[model samples]
Target: MMHEHIEALRQRFLHSGDDADLPIVDAHHHFWDLERNYHPWLRDVPRIPFRYGDYEAICHDFLPDDYFARAGNHRIVKTVMMEGEWDPRDPTGEARWATALHQRTGLPSAMAAQIWLDRDDVTDVLAAYRDLPLVRSVRHKPATVPRAAHRRDFSAPGSMRSEGWRRGYALLEASGLMFELQAPWWHFEEAAELARDFPRTRIVVNHTGLPADRSDEALAAWRRALDALARHPNVWLKISGIGEQGAAWSVARNGPVVRDAIACFGTARCLFASNFPVDSLVVTLDDLFTGFKTIVAGCTREERLALFYDNACALYRI
Candidate 1:
């Protein structure tokens, strides 16, 4: 009975035709080979049973061709590849793999490489990866860390404010590469500070600050942080990452939140991203994009175009 109920809900979201018109550029998507890699989190998280094998079972390996065939119905002209935590044992291997993927697929117009900001020699690391033709940004992914890894006062300024990270960011800025901010929602202020300090760097805020679950305080704090960050002209926000939070959230639940983000960031600085496969765990690709389109339905065609495609093209130099 419980399994049937879950199926019914999934079908409802899947069948919903909300993305008929938008010209999308999926700014966030991932691909991984579980066999060749080790995902520590996936090993323990029983809830997400979809391994690379499962992806193959469901859709034949979640490759670019599969993604284009399934999610490209809305006309995804370009996509930006976000790094899946690659074999951390070899650190630099992910970028090399992504570059190989770029050569093979030719869909990821830009690549957001994963890097460890805590590394002592981050400048050298940045220099090494920055030369890749498709490498447009770097993501440290502070958000994906375990909740226990964070402190109540994450803003108290220590490692985050360190010279090493800032210097590495400076190298990124100098290279004219964008910085994809992927920290938890609460770290918006810290992200904002980085934006302010590195005026020349383009900072793209992934997932509208990744608002915590439907708590009033979380929502309120997310709004306030977005407001503060919006003041910085260099900071842009992506309307992505919603579906992964849970399966219970729907267009009905998330539309207003996305609308509020558009209002705060303005269509020019905001781009729609389908944070794919990760999002697929919660909602179908079509449904996810459909929900986003529905949220921005009230906008004029020109404004909608910017959110759907133009903004991402410019941001990633696609």
Candidate 2:
């Protein structure tokens, strides 16, 4: 039934002649080999607490073929690979693997490599990433983010407020790379501070600040944080991962979040991404994208093109 519904939705978008053939540069996604690499979250005995609940279904190797198969009707010309949590011992290992994967697959035109900002070897890791041609940015999810409470606390060892993390973050400009920040809305003010301190480096917030709570008050708080962060011209937003726990993805639930994000960041500073494999736990590729297209169906063709294609290319240099 869900597949039938998705097909119907896909047909609606395909029939919308204005932007049906719009080329897409999937701003974010992932490919992993559980056999070759040690992803602690996926391979560990106890699964780490995930936003999408139990994700055992995706525990196997997810290579390029898997991604291509799930891409469905969307004409995904290019993609930006987000770093999966690979072995932390050798931080540059993921980038090397992705570079090799791209050589064979010719997908993931760019990559956001993993780098622990607070690690002692961060300087060397950043240097290694700079040498990898596919690496366009790096991700280091800050420590000590408040989950249940919306309170601000940046004193944790690897939090964005930490001196060591800031030192590593400051080097991104010199390395010619940007940053991928994955934190909840409550942390955006701290992120805004990080953005202010290092004005030269670009920071792209992951998962729309993880707006998981869709309550009226929660959304208002998310919007306030977005407003604060958007004030910093260096910050950008990705409209993906809006799925709710234990619920199917639909336009009715996610459309407002998408539209609000674009309104906050504007089309130029906003990009559309699948956050695939991770988001696939809640939504299929076709249905997820169909929701994106349908929600913005009333917008101008140029605006739609910017969200779906142009912005990603420019932001990631894909």
Candidate 3:
């Protein structure tokens, strides 16, 4: 499926916009050592059935050089490393490894380290990751609504509404760390409610609301959820991973999602990211950014700059 119209997609979404030369601060991406990390999904599964179906192409090592080469024309001045779930028991290990990469390669100016928010020792974990030089945010894959395409349901029952989770969430305020969230569109209202409660703590939603169900009804619901979440000033939306879950990853398919998110959150509160390697299973970095550039082609230079770079730098404090 990827090979059939890939050339056509490259041609159609390939051309860069006026701000093509502008430096990009890739807000969401990962660097992993599958050997050192315990990523069961990447290690045990031979194929990724959902998010990025049959992930063989991207299942191997993807270091800094590989990412830079794939980024192609875009000048990736800096990036924020989204913590790949490595050894759940050793959450800080991922940050330490990424920080070493930062020293050696100088990419991922910030680290969004993962923490088990439901754990009793979560506060200590937060303090540990927060003190790391580049660590700016904490990401815990919140249990999102289940989709038919998924092989396993990783969502914990009543997590978003639970008292333990909210208590852990409050710790982010003390650590000065933002929350990098990942969940289905069905859960946005709960997310919005969290944003309202934690007005001081920043929350960045992953994907363009992760519209897994693409029916007109589903899209409308996703939009309504976005509207609800957008009302909170502390929340920001990340326009990446568009194709990661949405099987039909193309300019025509994703343009509306990105445009709608930017419209919903406005340029100031919105950001662009490359959910790379994971997204690499669907599209290349060049194609991803190219598609994004095409989506916002009609906007002014400043707005384009804001989406492609500035907003991420400010939000992540990179």
Cα lDDT computed for each candidate against the true fold: 0.71, 0.85, 0.78
Q: Which stretches of candidate 3 lie over 4 Å from their true place?
A: 1-17, 45-49, 147-158, 244-248
How does each model score on TM-score?
0.81, 0.93, 0.88
Per-residue lDDT of candidate 1, residues 1-318 (tens digit): 633553443344345523444456788887765655555444434435432223323322356876866674675667898877665655667677777877887767788887776666566667787668778888775433334465544633233455656656767766667888876666666777888888888888887887655678767777888998899999999888765333444878898789879888999999988776666656778777767777777776667778887788888887
lDDT tens readout by residue for model 2, 139-206:
99997555575456546778888889888888899998999999888888789898998899999999
Q: How many residue pairs clash in each candidate?
A: 1, 0, 2
Residue 135 of model 1 has an lDDT of 82
Can you rank all candidates by lDDT, best first? 2, 3, 1
Model 3: ten consecutive residues of lowest lDDT: 5-14
Clashing pairs in 3: 51-244, 143-155
Candidate 3 lDDT over residue span 190-287, tens digit each: 78778988899999998877875667887887888898899999999999887745365689888888888888899998988999988886788998
- Backbone clash pairs for candidate 1 read 56-61
Ordered by TM-score, highest first, the candidates read: 2, 3, 1
Top-lDDT candidate index: 2
Top candidate (TM-score): 2
> How far out, in Å, is residue 311 in model 2?
0.7
Question: Any runs in candidate 1 off by more than 4 Å, and if so which?
Answer: 1-21, 37-61, 143-159, 244-246
